[model samples]
Target: MKIVNFVGYSGSGKTTLIEKLIPIFCAQGLRVAAIKNAHHNFDMDKPGKDSYRYRRAGASQVIVRNADRWAMFSETPQGAPHLSELIAHLDPADLIVVEGFKSEDSDALRLEVFREIGRGEPPICQSDESICAVVSDKAREAFSALPVLDISSPEKVAAWITEKLQIKGIEKC
Candidate 1:
C-alpha cells in the first residue's frame, strides 16, 4: 500500500486537511486507512465495559467485536510502537494517511502542513529532508522551491498525491 505522512505543529491544520482529503479519495473508490500518533495517554474503552474489564484483568490484547466493526487494544508496556509495527496490524488498503510521527523514520512520503499561526516557529521541512512537499495557506512564493501546494484546495492536493504515488481506484465507492 502507498503511504503518506502529514506532519505539522499544533493548530497547523493538518487534521483539517486530512479530513477534507479522505472523502475525495473515497469518491474515487480507493481504500484509505489513517493512523494518528497521539502524544498523550488515551483510552478507547471505559470502565465497566466487558472489553475494558478484560483488559484491566491483564489481557495483553483485547478485541471487542460486533457485526458492524471490531476494535483491538494492545497493552503497550514497552511504550508506543513504531509506525511500521502499527501498520502491520492494519487491514489491506490502497493508501494510508498517517498523522503526526513527524520525526519517525519511514519510507512514506512526508508532507508538512504549514500555517503561519504567528508562533514565530519555522517549518519542520526546513530541517527534515524527508519532507517531500509543503501544503500551506500561503502561496508558492512563501517556500523556497520545496513544492508548495495550496492548503485551501484539497482536491488539488489529492490529485497531486494520486499522481505522485501513482494511485488509482479500481472500483467505485
Candidate 2:
C-alpha cells in the first residue's frame, strides 16, 4: 500500500481537500483510508454511552459494532503512537492519507497544503525534504522547485496523486 501525508497549518484546508479526494479515488475503484491526528483529550464516543462506560471502566480497548459498521477505540496512555504503528492497525488499502503529524520522522511522502491566510510562518515544504508537492490557492509561479497544484481543483490533485504514486485502480471494463 502507498501512503501520503498531508502536512500544513491548522487552516490550510487539509481536511477539506481530503474529503473531496476520497470520492474521486473511490470512483477510480481504489480503496482509500485516512488517518487524522486529533488534539489531546479528544473523545469520539459520547459520554454515558456503553462504549464510553467501558473505556471509563478501565478497558484498554473497546469495540463497538452494529449491523452497518464497527469501530475499535483503544486507549494509549503511553502517548500517541507512531504513524507506522497506527497504519498497521488499518486494513489494507490502495492509499492512506494522513492528516497532521507534520513533524513525524517517517519516510512517507508528504504533500504540503499552503494558503496565505496571514500566517507569517513559511510553508513546511520549504524546509521539509519529504514534501513532494505543494497544493495551494496561489498560482504555480508562487512555488520555486516543487510542483504547485490548485487547491480549488481536487480532481487534478487526485489525478496527480495517482500518477505520482503510480497507483492504478481497477479497470473500468
lDDT by residue (tens digit), candidate 2, 33-98: 999987557888999999999999999999999999999999988988999999999999999999
Q: Which residue pairs overlap in candidate 2's backbone?
A: none
TM-score of 2: 0.94
TM-score of each: 0.94, 0.94
Tens-digit per-residue lDDT, 1-173, candidate 1: 99989999989999999999998999899999999998877999999999999999999999888999999999989978999999998999999999999979999989999998989788888789899899998854545679888999999999999999999875573
Question: Going through the candidates in order, what is the number of backbone clashes in each?
Answer: 0, 0
Runs in model 2 lying further than 4 Å from the true structure? 140-142, 171-173
lDDT of 1 at 2: 98
Using alpha carbons, what is the TM-score of model 1?
Answer: 0.94
